[model samples]
Target: MSIVAFDLSRRLVAEALGTAILVATVVGSGIMADRLSEDAAVSLLGNTLPTGAILVVLITILGPISGAHFNPAVTLVFALRRDIEVNAALAYIAAQVAGGIAGTFLAHAMFDLPILQLSATARTGTGQWIAEAVAAFGLVFAILAGLRFRPDATPWLVGLYITAAYWFTASTSFANPAVAIARAFSNTFAGIRPVDLPGFIAAELFGALLAVAFAGWLLAEPKPPTTFKAAE
Candidate 1:
């Protein structure tokens, strides 16, 4: 057998690659927004819409290959739901963090930003915290519901939800840990404050855990004879 067989190691590598792609798109879009727009809200949406589109496309393309986690929050949810094992979840998280940093650095190089001027972990006060919680809860809830009723629709629905959340939430709905980490690299409008990383992560984790507990009850499996097949 090949040394890197179809196993956790390969899956971890795929997570790394997926996370890297995610961050590249995220930060690159931020660079584009900064270069192109002066209106912060418009700039935020400009970056977010495309980021959502890319996320859906990438997740659809890479979900089977690596589960397309790209986020520790998602990985942890999957693990809690028994969709992935512990070791694999840990590996996925590690890859995600590494890939996020790599993607930030790549964006730094691409935009010719100062080495330390990249975005940081986004955070907000109480109102924004509530917004983040709601956004994250909505995302995980939608994912679980899709998995239960329409597995084939998961990617697209997720993308749409994220896109909407970006506009709706006060904090612009940064629901993923890896995405937050990657955002830390850009000093553009999308940038988060490094000092606020802990709060953002805590809010996200709270949302995730809350979603996990409720997801099982909220999302029951589809009725018999309606088993979901993979998307085409």
Candidate 2:
């Protein structure tokens, strides 16, 4: 039905569960892809497809419940837009972060790797930071434009955009802060160094805010012209 049909608790649960599964998909697929391929490109393709596919599925199924935010940057955008209440937005962010960490652990457990580990994969430099910003800008723009133009197609739009962004972006488009934070716990192909986290998160947030500003002007509907009635 509608997003408002669900209560805050249910919405939060969906957000948590959806984010958990999303992080699991990213981490688990990266591990599997790395194991299966010697070619970095092949492994990345392997990593990208499952993530794109799962987004389509997860957003389709969960969009009605929590609007399928799954990302703190996205939640913040909505909070800024006043689409969701401030307190609820905070709760949603907390749930997403918690779920994302849990998802990292879940992937580790499934792969029989150590659950508690810090990522040492160094993802830094100006190009990488700029790439993360661009990636997040594309993501938030995609979501907003999709909602404005073709609400029914948002799931596919997001999935396909991310699929392409993963290849194009130097950082492979870890556009979600929660996802970035979670990935920092796993030293895998999808992972980023814990030390690299602040830059990525900051870039992601800045990009998301930019999208909101741009979309607010770009996607907004024109107001009806004011008419003065003839003097009676």
Candidate 3:
């Protein structure tokens, strides 16, 4: 295959695999949390830890393969930053949304709660909105900086950033639209309300876009010699 064609195929396969892993981890963690404890804090940890761990591992594993976008908003930010091609970004985003829906259904089936009321997300008012914005900005900034200027630092840095965001952010650090949508199906401990999904996703995506724009303006173009290095 030509270089461009090979790159295209790799991206699609990576999106499929990354999304599968993301949903599996998210749904699996929710099921475990439901069975383990009813306390909100314990449940939070149970859900966040698994998701964080999975994200860390998957980003490390799939970052080179597909930039480990795993989320539609992330892809949007990358596209806006001109780090990814438009067509590929659209394809990745579509894959993410579809994967999220599939993941939610799978989770429902696995838990024998096909109509289970997921732990839908709902954080309204000014304070909650601010919190969500901050969380999304931090997440996208970390990803952009890590990928652009410090590729070698991604694995652990990305993991740690997500873990911290989960604990600190008021929205429980959703940071990912696809994951948010997928979590709505579990209804066990980490589901978001379908009604609230659109607004929350908008906030998160807008925040990420702002971050990408700011990062581009504030930071130098990632024209460092290493930027040209091939993904491993």
lDDT of 2: 0.93
Write down the TM-score for model 3: 0.84
- The order of the candidates by TM-score, greatest first, is 2, 1, 3
**Superposed model 1: Cα runs more than 4 Å off:** 1-5, 118-122, 221-232
Top TM-score hit: 2
lDDT of 3 by residue, 7-100 (tens): 7677777776777777876777777786888887887788778777887787777777777778888888777667778998888887887776
Q: Cα deviation of 220 in candidate 1 (Å)?
A: 3.0
- For each candidate in turn, the TM-score is 0.88, 0.95, 0.84
Residues 19-134, model 2: lDDT tens digits: 99999999999999999999999999999999999999999999998999999999998888889989999999999999999999999999999998899999999999999999
Worst 10 residues of 2 by lDDT: 1-10
User: How high is the lDDT of residue 84 in model 2?
Assistant: 90
lDDT of model 1 at position 146: 81
Clashes of each: 6, 0, 8
- Cα lDDT, all candidates: 0.79, 0.93, 0.74
- Name the better of 1 and 2 by lDDT: 2
